[model samples]
Target: MKLVVAYIRHEAFEPIRLELLELGFPSITIIEVKGSGRQKGITEQYRGSALTNYLRPKIKIECVVADGDTQTIVDTILKHARTGSIGDGKVFVIPVEQAYRIRTGESGEETLQIHPDAAAAAT
Candidate 1:
């Protein structure tokens, strides 16, 4: 298993989501977050004054998928999230030791999938 975490601009969320769903990987977690990277934030003007906000908002997308799906998920995020802008955000892949589904006590990849019929219906 692997964990794919991506911090992306708000504008890219919907497209990225749809792409993942169509790819049959719909299990994901979304979080609204604030942070900054090499872009170092942006400067804005208010009341004839300049204000710099170091933290920008990003939507964090987290997915625990099968190891084989890691690359595809990252590629999908890149395809949808890029805007050629500084604050476009980042993607990280991490090793996952294990995973579980409390309801059925299912573990590993079994817990990360949707029934084929259900997945197709969703798309």
Candidate 2:
């Protein structure tokens, strides 16, 4: 299995989410995160005071899928998230040793599948 983690601009979340759903990948974990990359951070003016090196707000989207789906998921995120600008974000693909669904006790690749019938069966 592979875990795909994408750090994207806040504005890109909705589009990327919709695209992922359309691509048959609806199970995702989203987190609000703050960090800096090559752009190092940005400076902003707040109440006539310059705020330097402020961490930018980003949406972290995490999905665990079968290894074969890694590239497709990454491409889907990129297709919807890229804005042709700096701070667009980054995607990291990591190996997942295992995954478990607490309610159904599904594990591994089965935990990543989205078939309603399979879910019902698991229960």
Candidate 3:
């Protein structure tokens, strides 16, 4: 299995989620995060004061899929998340040693599949 982690602009979350769902990759975990990379954060003016080195808000989307689906998922995220500018964010693919569905004790690839039948069986 592979875990695809994508850090994307906050505004891109909904579009990315919808695209992923259309692609049959509906199982995702989203986290609101703040960080900066090559863009090195940004400067903003508040109350006539300059706020420097402020971490930008980003959405982190994590989806674990069978190894074969990793690239497709990554592409979907990139397509939906890109804005032709810096701070557009990045995606990382990590190898998952194992995964377990706590209820049914399903492990490995089965743990990542999202299906009504499978979910019911897991309980």
Candidate 4:
């Protein structure tokens, strides 16, 4: 299994989620995060005054999927999250050692069976 972690522009969350669902990769967890890369955060203008904020608001989306589904999910996130500018965010795919559903005691692949997309798609 692979764990896909993506830090994306806050505004791109909805589209990414919808696209992931359409691509049959819907199981995900999202969190509000703040961080920066090369360009760092950005400047904001308020009341005719400009303020530089180094920590930008971003959305972190995490999903665990079969190894084969890694690329597709990464591409989907990149496609929708790109803004042709710095600080667009990044995606990381990590190997998942194991997983288990606490409620049902389902482990490994069975843990993912509860995911509608994973269950519907015959990967």
TM-score of each: 0.90, 0.86, 0.88, 0.83
Model 4, residue 53: C-alpha shift (Å): 0.8
lDDT of 4 by residue, 33-110 (tens): 988678775789999999889988889999998888789999989989999888888899999999998876778876
The candidate with the higher lDDT, 1 or 3, is 1
User: Candidate 1's C-alpha lDDT?
Assistant: 0.92
Candidate numbers, best lDDT first, in rank order? 1, 2, 3, 4
**Every candidate's lDDT:** 0.92, 0.89, 0.89, 0.86
Show model 4 residue runs off by greater than 4 Å. Answer: 44-50, 115-123
Best by the lDDT measure: 1
Model 1 TM-score, 2 decimals: 0.90
lDDT of 1 by residue, 30-109 (tens): 99999989889589999999999999999999999999999999999999999897888999999999888787777888
Question: Candidate 1, clashing residue pairs?
Answer: none
Q: What does the lDDT read for residue 27 in candidate 4?
A: 86
Please report the candidate that would top TM-score against the real structure: 1
Model 3 deviation from native, Cα RMSD in Å? 2.6
Q: List runs of model 1 lying over 4 Å from the truth.
A: 115-123
Cα miss at 116, model 1 (Å)? 8.3
Q: Give the range where candidate 2 is weakest over 10 consecutive residues by summed lDDT.
A: 113-122
Model 3 misplacement above 4 A: 115-123
